[model samples]
Target: MAGSRTKGSDTLRAAQMYYLQDLTMDAIARELRVSRSTVSRLLSTARETGLVQVQIRSPMDSAPELERAIRAKYRVDVHVVPVADSVNEVEVMERVCLQAARTIGPLVDSNAIIGVAWGATISAVSRHLTRKITHGSVIVQLNGAGNTQTTGITYASEIMRRFGNAYGARVEQFPVPAFFDQAETKKLMWRERSVLRILGLQERMTMAIFGVGSVDADVPSHVYSGGYLDEVDIDSLAASAVVGDVATVFFRADGSDAGIVLNERSSGPELALLRGVRRRICVVSGESKLNGLRGALAAGLATDLILDEATARSLVESDGAAEDAVGGFLPLDTASGR
Candidate 1:
């Protein structure tokens, strides 16, 4: 009797291993000295007795339909960060920033020129970059880091210092304003030999990292908070139906630079210029930034996007989010209403 009971218990344990631990049925049968059929029966019993339960976890489980819609619509690399129900906008942005930093840190290479835009979101990303120094690299501020209220160079300098410290590379600071008072002023400044030298370096950038700024972003936009834009500029942006900006170049909800005057005075590269770079990474957060994020995608300003899950889901579900424009999955059907 003892021998028979021991054999049955061993069979049950084998079934537990096979079903619960995902061990092959054949392997379990061989180990337990039982027929395959017997192993199958034992597994069935284990399941029926609630000893085994299988579950699959998907990143898109929170919004499956949204993920499918974004994938089908944009067809670019999109990372939808997951957000907890109780999280605030600041927390969301932090999560997205950290994720972006983690993603870009490993992609950095020796002797590479990394073009970076100035903003709170990018600042957050810089704080999270913890990679060890492995290459001779250079961090170049893409746009003039100064603004009307203060020299934005300090913020950019701090960010570059951190990056250089991590990789033991040199840092280049662009000491110009985010936008000049007039287009002519910008045109004349571009002619300066020193300015031209930095501009030349931008053309050879290996990777460009930026952040999208929404006029009504749930979290305070860096442009607004950093004093880059004054009341007049903000009013002008609003009057022009500007939705968002990448590096101070404003775009409409459909990603068109239709009526925004600031784009001409902006220090960063134009949309076309940014497209020439190999990698363009845009980091964004906040549900209110959905339209802005969509605008960036429509303008071909971003090759890779890092966003909070809630914002990503919202972007995916809204047909207006991924308008067709500038080739790629999102086509530019300007005739259609946004």
Candidate 2:
């Protein structure tokens, strides 16, 4: 009887190795010092005993739950993009762009001022926009398109042209750096009547769209890898405990503005200004951007969020972790303007 029991245990072990460990029957047989037939029999027994119960977790399965959690937490419209586990960075960006375009296309109308931020993700969205042009609609660049290394006007122009062509609306470009070298320059530019006119249109924008920037995002974030920030600037952002950004403005993990020097130079609207917009849509992706996404929410920058299922899950799971790191819930004052 003892010998019989030993043989049974060997059979179970062989089955576990073959079925659960995903080894070939022959490999299991060799490892267990048994025949292939024995390995096969063990695998059958393992299945019978429910030891090898296989489940294929669908990436789509988690999207509903994620959307629920995100909406409940942030009180905003959330669209969770279903992505397979093996999706690459470019594919992820494409999905995000597609979804954003679908969502935004119907929302636009004549006499609407639509503000756009320049970045790879937003550029992708612009490419996918198929809406027909209507009268009195205008697409405006939100910030200066220039960076430290080069002028990003080409990128900005491409987005503007696409939107203008699709909507048959006028395109208004900011025609400046992503950030001014000095606050005084920004102040002086704001005083220029022509600049002020464009800025006024931006301020009155009916709808605004942008992408979040993660400090360690897998998909290259425009602000981090876009040659907008130098080594010293990156180092300073890290030292300031920055997690993520919306429109090139860094925010802390708790959704508070970092008040970094770079912000002084940034041309994007302040968080408060973003919140004041009738509709502020933010598109982001990747598990790496989880923290940044959270910060954007905590800061109340996103009235609507478009993200992938994986990222949405990570954000929900990170609540406790963020509270410990940041020491409080982010204030809900939409007018605070971090």
Highest lDDT: which candidate? 2
- Residue-by-residue lDDT tens digits, candidate 2, 125-146: 8888765447898888888879
What Cα-based lDDT does every candidate model obtain? 0.76, 0.79
Residue 25 lDDT in model 1? 81
Clash pairs (backbone) in predicted model 2: 133-167, 133-168, 272-337
Total backbone clashes of candidate 1, pairs 3 or more residues apart or in separate chains: 8
Give the alpha carbon lDDT tens digit for every residue of 158-214 in model 1: 987877776677888888988898999999999999999889888888889999888
Best by TM-score: 2
- Residue 99 of model 2 has an lDDT of 76
Deviating ranges (above 4 Å) for candidate 1: 1-60, 63-68, 320-338
